[model samples]
Target: MRLTRYLLALFLGLGLCAGPGLADTPGVGLKPDLRLLVDISGSMKTSDPDNLREPAIELIVRLLPEGSKAGIWVFGEDVRELVPHGVVDSAWRERAREAVPQIDNSGQRTNIPAAITAATYDLERLDPGYRTSIVLLTDGKVDVAESPMVNASSARRLLSATAPNLGATGIAVHTIALSNEADWPFLRALARSTSGIAEKAESPQALSSIFVQALEMVAPTARVPLSDSGFAIDDSVSEFTLLVFFGGARNRLELVDPDGARYSANSSDVDWYQNQQFALVTVASPSAGNWRVKAPDSASLRVNVISDLKLDVDPLPNSLPAGRQTELGLRLTEQGQVLTDAEVLAAFDLSVVITGPGGKQLSIPVSREYALPADGEYRIVIPPFDAPGRYQVVAQLQAQSLQRELPMYVEVVAPPEQPTLVTRGQEPPEDDFQAPLLWLGGVLALLLLAIWLHLRRRKRRKLEIWEKRARQLASNDSEPLEGVSADQ
Candidate 1:
């Protein structure tokens, strides 16, 4: 996630560079470029005693110079760059104007880390002359994590990771606390950390002037601090994770504009960065322009940005049985710093079906997006398959066609029983309970036939008896007729 943010910010910093706005910073000629990081977190919509958000927005719009360049970022549970930095043209202003009509401040997550990461990563690609920064105005404290409230400790950790080492980068952070009950310590530390002034909106009236003053802060000496959240060296293999701590509460955060305009971090714009944080990111070797400890604070922590040895998966096993999952051992010197997203492939023969645990076979699943745990060793679970034979396991860099395979003994383990049954002391007997019914039906049919035959025989005998009786009567009549001649 941090890496993605880095790319996004990097694009702005490297691509669409804009010019300066406020020439107020007298002789420096550094007309600061301002990107408003608005705190659209719902509380902003409250029409309070004097509708705080309306006043805040009005104050910001009024202070901008005619050609002031600004970007819009609305941060809440989910932070988004509403507008990216570019020259302040009527088109840009129109976008902002349209934004005001549709934008309502309400989100569940106050993604301070997302905002800061995007801003800082983008800042690095801008010109050294233009002053660029975020003007953050927030009424709440950093609520991060899966919790409803901003996760205090996690928010602090995140902030520490991305907190700009502006003194290291020659930029400054100006912070304004708009709420009465914000984590003063966090805000104060952010300003102090970046060697900028931190102020409070004691009253709505003072909010505007405080913002203007905050903006006027000049750029520090020009220096490029390391950009990767931390350093990633290949001391260990398999996978690695590097932790970066930037204490927003105690450092200056310099912002570089997309269009080369530099601006100080101060104003009514909460999106400008009310604070800073640290993050974990991957990096290539040489570790140029990195940073080390300069100050400490409540949000302060140490980090190791170096390439440690990684658990090498040399001659990595490439193939296994179709229905079995393979386990591999990994070792690491840096322990947590390696690639989890490395693309691993397994190849199978045509006759040997290698369906995955999900039934699909012949797939390249492992890639560079997987988050590598601190342990360099990972148990690569290969889904089971029906085919029983040797298969090849290939470890390749994600997106790179390169691949390494390991041919091994393939044993097709029987698939686990479906509708499996288990009891305390015995195996379930296999019974064909439906078989007896067929024999029972045949016997019933035979018995019915025998009864029908017996009835038929009895009826035939009765008919014969009737015939005999009739004959006897006729004979008797005839004999009698001897006495009475023609009567028969």
Candidate 2:
């Protein structure tokens, strides 16, 4: 029985070691990992006439945010890594672009199975701290060999199985069909299985645009503000969240949206992480107004919320377009709703602060206010952002003791690049999706080690018991029968 328990414990230890656990705690400050897989089969020669593939690749390589990691793969009968996975920088960008033209169309067939497998392998090699994805751009179907593993059905099945496993590891597979001839159904199904999008592009222009969009989606940017009392949510803002970190003692929090809707910390929408002293609230379709937050005064940590506030001074051509006038827009709301008409807005005083890319600061003239189609929406005009870079705009509103400020960050690229339209404002932190997996892995490893040691000690104790029993029997046999003593 003792031996049976020892064996059982040993098997349990092995079982634990076999399980690769998941991390539950979120990880912070990790960059995204994107791997691009482009089909280089002969069909591409007809489908991609303008040769926009290389240009799209180059553009994506150029625009990827710094610190993010990306790799490029060209797939034919076999897969080739045009650019090895590495952190994005000026040097890396140059190397990635240089390799784009090197992609040749010598292979006659497309082996999507091999390509996907290779990309998955590369992504798996990433430091599990990243939000990883594979952006697959293909213009044709899976035309590889007809084998159990290489046939179309087999390929789909392999991907079908791999997709969920990748998702389990926090990796997604986004598919972009560059032409109508591509296997849209299969691609879409593959992407859906992995919790990714399948985008279709029929023309070179559309494909180029999709490439930029894909890269942007793969590598998102984020900003956190340090403030107290209230933070701004843009008029154009949609859904947003507030993460409040408390310390020392529990803190009470209250949230007021633009439409005057009030929510408390114990509201149904609020999620609390008691162990971490963090509470998060997600607001859907947030009103375009300054959301007020009342946090505990004793909460010493910085408490800033990323809310929806759209206040911008944008040049028609965000590239500034030389002498064009810049359009300034602001949306006002009270409590948590949009304010329309002078009756609802009679109690408010509003002003805007404009800071140019050149560090120049000015205030928009109150007389310059013009009405828009929506209630509480206001617009004005400003001089073009002649010099290139980022500009900061802030709009302020005060109603009695309640004060709100909305901050908008705009980018003005140099001439030649088309104007960039930013529909989304500041992004939330890109927390690690793999953190839970990592934490689980660590705990499982430790548990397995402990179980192994315990089982080994139990086995040693069992062996010691058997040895003692054998010695006792041997001594009795040497002492002769009970009736016959040492004299006999």
Candidate 3:
């Protein structure tokens, strides 16, 4: 019980310090430190023939918030740093975008261990203010050598040595297997052991979406809901970016602002980066009204915004023991102050969707009754977990003008097996209780036998003493008679 209390206290302390927050100031919250590792082995020539990973990497780089740190590494037989690790800014984004073209299927071997080691080389020291993670994408097995034994040995080393080391340093290693031929078991185990996520990209076309999901898990940002390519921009929004996936359409993408003014790639105020698969556009000081995107028929859009109104969620721990109850805390803040307006609070809808092992999902609606008295924080208690496996919790918050989703991953470990008590009239398992019961019975019988022998010996000794005394007394008494008898 003392150990459990200590662990819970430690977890609470870390959560309080490392949780992400959004404030009116730009860099006043927890920052994300993400390392991306891409596999460039020869098998990628078939797995990713269209090279969709390039755009996926570019999209993730562009979407990273300003204060976060990110770097890229490409691995084949060896590892090469494509982008220098640094704070995310215009220059870093540009460097990452330029380096995306260098990714190709030119190498001979998939050296996953080397890639992980190189990517996490500088992450030995942990920063409480930063959330560090690694996103690894691969398409083949561990084939660093001709001998299968050597490859298997490398995998074992990774599981036994590297994964634990990374977990100890609080670095999550999210793995993405790009094809069916990839070493999925190894990747899954690595991610699960390190409190990260494991994903599979069935085709090259699915890489970008998977990358976006990973980004959400690593560095979640508040978003404005874009329904049917249209979203609302309020006074709180300072800037917003539109990530439009056009599905290889050749048509120009245009954005309609609140004033119904259309802007395209050639617009003076918009920064646009176009690719064969998607177009990323950024607008500063967006007008307060409705905005729409004009793109191809099948285009999908996501709007990420910078605003003073934010929802801050407490961070979940990497792993939890089974049957442990967890309380998830969330606060709605505006301009660095807790929002207490009853009208706005009434409009807020908060809930969580938990996906457990084997694709089981549980939806929980967080009621306002769970809110604290005066503070604008809502503490929702999660149901105690019964099963043990990886679980994904997505906290969704929606208001009249804003929507945000935070994706968190956690591993639920089975608790230690406890000793079972045998009740009266209930038979215990033979394997557990039979030998001990037999030994105890044998000990009791031997104790009874020893006691009986001791009592019998004592009785015999007393009898002999009494007999000796009687004999002596008779001899004494008979001494006078003995004279008479001798005389006789």
Candidate 4:
């Protein structure tokens, strides 16, 4: 199964658990784990199991969050060998990949009992430190075994009756019946058992769709901020596919267009990590306003995307002509109150298009740096303008953490027709730079150098007397000088 291949990835990425720091605890994070249980029945052979290919593979990938862990299992009449329980890592994914291609209708019936048991057991490997979960996907009526104490129906009954135990075990079971063929009795029982809900899908496509939706519904989403020291958007956007970085775990996010038409992305068709891996959202364009989490499909983590946005170009004629040498300053602002210990992504400029007079065009790149999340004006240095004529300084403010960009505009004015370097005391002027400040600093540096030279000369004069005395003593014989130098 592809999942088998990820055994190493899972092991290295998600495992153990943590919580977002304590009130007094310093440098602490959250640890959480979610297990995926797949039902591989003979009927599943009719169509390819493993969500046809992807949904199953994504299991371990989704769990690769910081302070988190994931495990995998498949039950076909009986639970297939554990896929990624020990050292949960990329190898688990590899196994999942290996498991899917060879999946056959081997099992005659679905075994909910063994499936849930395996899932719960895999979770037991972790201590009480993590948020535990079991995600079970199936599409059939469970055939109750002829057990004296509990039949399949009775087992289903047990799941409901055993809710507290599941919770106390740090386990929560989320149930999804991929097809109408699923057994509601068992599904409902499982949900009631683990304080989870039962969601049903009508078609194969819908099934896959609901599976992804269900994952997002229960999966955690993080709130992150976007920064662009160059040009960035302060105006809000929405319906954009996005992602939020939360330390080790990233949230898969989707923006729904508020276009009066019921346009929404089916979870199965969407990617939770589609946006920049765990990015801080400043503005959700097409959204009514700035960033906020809304899971119309399922429950999602509460997140807020806010930014203090400001942009500037340097050498502030604040304006430049195309092809002229001038500095562009960029200032990105964010609400410092928020950030949550996250770092702003590296800054960059995009859309390097320049529209010059008479429709001439040119392009250039601006550079930036990253900093701690704070509500302040961060800056970037712009590169030289590339074209001539009245041009607009156009670029998109880009952050490594952002999926989209904030747009920027600059007014490019022509350089002086008869350009002349203005000297101090002669500027009525076209540019206002810190030339005076630079001159002051240069003068101070010269003064300090002169003072240092004077001190060295005085010290050299004082040392001359000692040197002459030493020379006079040396003129005497070694033994004579040693005994009578002072008397001499």
Question: Which candidate number would show the highest TM-score if scored against the true structure?
Answer: 3
Model 3 residue 263 CA deviation in Å = 2.2
**Tens-digit per-residue lDDT, 180-254, candidate 3:** 999899998898778787888978877888888788778877777667778887666789888887766675688
Alpha-carbon deviation at 310 in model 2, angstroms: 16
Give the best candidate by lDDT.
Answer: 3
Off by over 4 Å in 3: 1-29, 247-252, 317-325, 333-367, 373-377, 384-488
lDDT of 4: 0.47
Give the distance in Å from residue 238's predicted Cα in candidate 1 to where it truly belongs.
65
Indicate the residue-level lDDT of 6 in model 2: 38
Worst 10 residues of 4 by lDDT: 16-25
lDDT of 2 by residue, 30-127 (tens): 45788899988888888887676776676566557667778888888889888988888988987886788887666677888788788777554668
lDDT at 433, model 3: 86
Reference-based TM-score, model 4: 0.41
Assess each prediction's global lDDT (C-alpha) against the native. 0.45, 0.62, 0.79, 0.47
Cα displacement (Å) at residue 235, model 4: 18
lDDT score at residue 69, model 4, on the 0-100 scale: 64
Kindly indicate the candidate among 2 and 4 with the higher TM-score: 2
RMSD in Å for model 1: 23.0
In candidate 3, which residue pairs clash? none
lDDT of 3: 0.79
The C-alpha TM-scores of every prediction are: 0.36, 0.42, 0.71, 0.41
Rank candidates, lDDT, best first.
Answer: 3, 2, 4, 1
